[model samples]
Target: MRGLLILAVAVIPAVAQNPVVHLTNATHPASREFQVGDRFEILITGAANQSISVRTTMRGRTDWGPIIGWTNTSGRWSTSGQFEKGDFGDWSEVWTVGGKVANPALHFSVGAPCLKGGQGFAASTGVNLVISCETADGRQTFGTASDSEPFRTPDGRVVRGRVRSNMTADQYHAEILQYLITSRASDVRSGRHGDEAGDLIMKMIGPNALNEDETRNVLSIIRAAFERPEPIPQTARDPSRTLLLLRNLADSADRESVKQQIVETVAYVLAR
Candidate 1:
């Protein structure tokens, strides 16, 4: 009997299409000027069953630079990597593929990095996006893209440029406190203080006990507002509401000095 001839067929899987990556400032799609808090988006298509990685670098510099303040907002896409501090003390984020998801869209907010003196970006820093993907066929593809226009922090002039590298920690802390105070004051003047105002105040104080100088500065601002007469536009000055919030914080304060200062400020407001 003739030996039976058997033929084996090898089936090959289809290769995945190369992914397209797009990075844009969703908050201001047409403009390159980004404020302290603005949203940035990364859209990835044709990435089914492929692994992807996203990295960032400054436009001209090869070394990684700070990623502004990157806070992820989208739940659709997930990442295993996190913001890593570089050797130069700058920060950058690497988003590694967590799972195989199709057409992932990522959204994040970019705020000014906390500088030595709470200063903003000194120059118009252009952050470039780099993406790499491994296809199902084991082929690697890489792409580098950036925003349509270079990002410029127009408010840098208002907040002042970046702090000097030689600034002391104490000076940095003081600058942060001053910035917070000035911001809150602006909110009050613009009638932007809302019900969540107290939450913001507490965030400014943080969990640690404030130093004597910090405590004094906070009280001084409260006193100045408390003593001011009702403005022509009543909405312009809501000292009572602000004081009520501070009073609540005072009641929960852990430090005697902080509590005392807040209480004294509240009392002054109540007395008026």
Candidate 2:
């Protein structure tokens, strides 16, 4: 199958300064800028000169949620973030990283509340730069802070997260789904994309992919994408469209259990 992820990195616009962050690799020419969805590496040139924050801020949790914080240890520093599905069918995370570093600081941000996940990093002088992501909700972190691991549904038609660090916005995910559905709905409609998205899914999902793995990643991405700063108001018009999309993926992939779960979720959301 074909996947858009294989496409080369696209160009990005310049990030504003101050409270705004510029996440980039030192190798790129300064003349060019990264767009909100252009993927780039964060390189620390000076000890205290480097800091990155999420363009969006997440609320601190009273008992749970992404309470992300990090400390600098010896010259070695590491920061890790994990997100999992909650009892109420929400994605929540608890993030912490500690290490000594020249700068001794890590910047983290979120698009919504701690409900989805956390984003941050640490810098140590020379220690290994360890960035770990895990989920108790049974989802797999794709090995970076970028996106969820890729996998296929039981039917053999591959599917995975359409969102990544570069496109760290709900609108991005929504647009991507809309594009895929609009393009394929005629043949597959709310179903699966044959080659394009499939090929991209292979690269991300990899060989170790499992059925549960794919389910967790897909739902987490969608829920995270649709999540609001506050709990989705139980309103009739609050993005009830996703119910069909989510259920379609599940049914098309033959995930009966997940499809039923989504149907119930749709009822709850619509009832609100």
lDDT (Cα atoms) of all candidates against the true structure: 0.36, 0.29
lDDT of 1 at 62: 17
Backbone clash pairs for candidate 1 read none
lDDT of 1 by residue, 14-125 (tens): 2334333344555678964333233444444333333333333222211112222211222122211111111111222223232212222333333332423332222322
TM agreement with the true structure for every prediction: 0.29, 0.22
Candidate 2, residue 241: how far the Cα is off, in Å? 2.9
**Residue 9 miss distance in model 2 (angstroms):** 32
lDDT of 2 by residue, 1-272 (tens): 11111111123322322122123322334624421122233322212222211111112111111212221221111222122111111112212111111222223321111213645333333422223233333323221221243322111123344444576443343444434322323222212222222323222322211233344445444433333324333442344345544444454343567667556555544443
**Model 2: how far is 135 from its true place, Å?**
43
Query: What is the Å distance of residue 268 in model 2 from its true position?
Result: 2.8
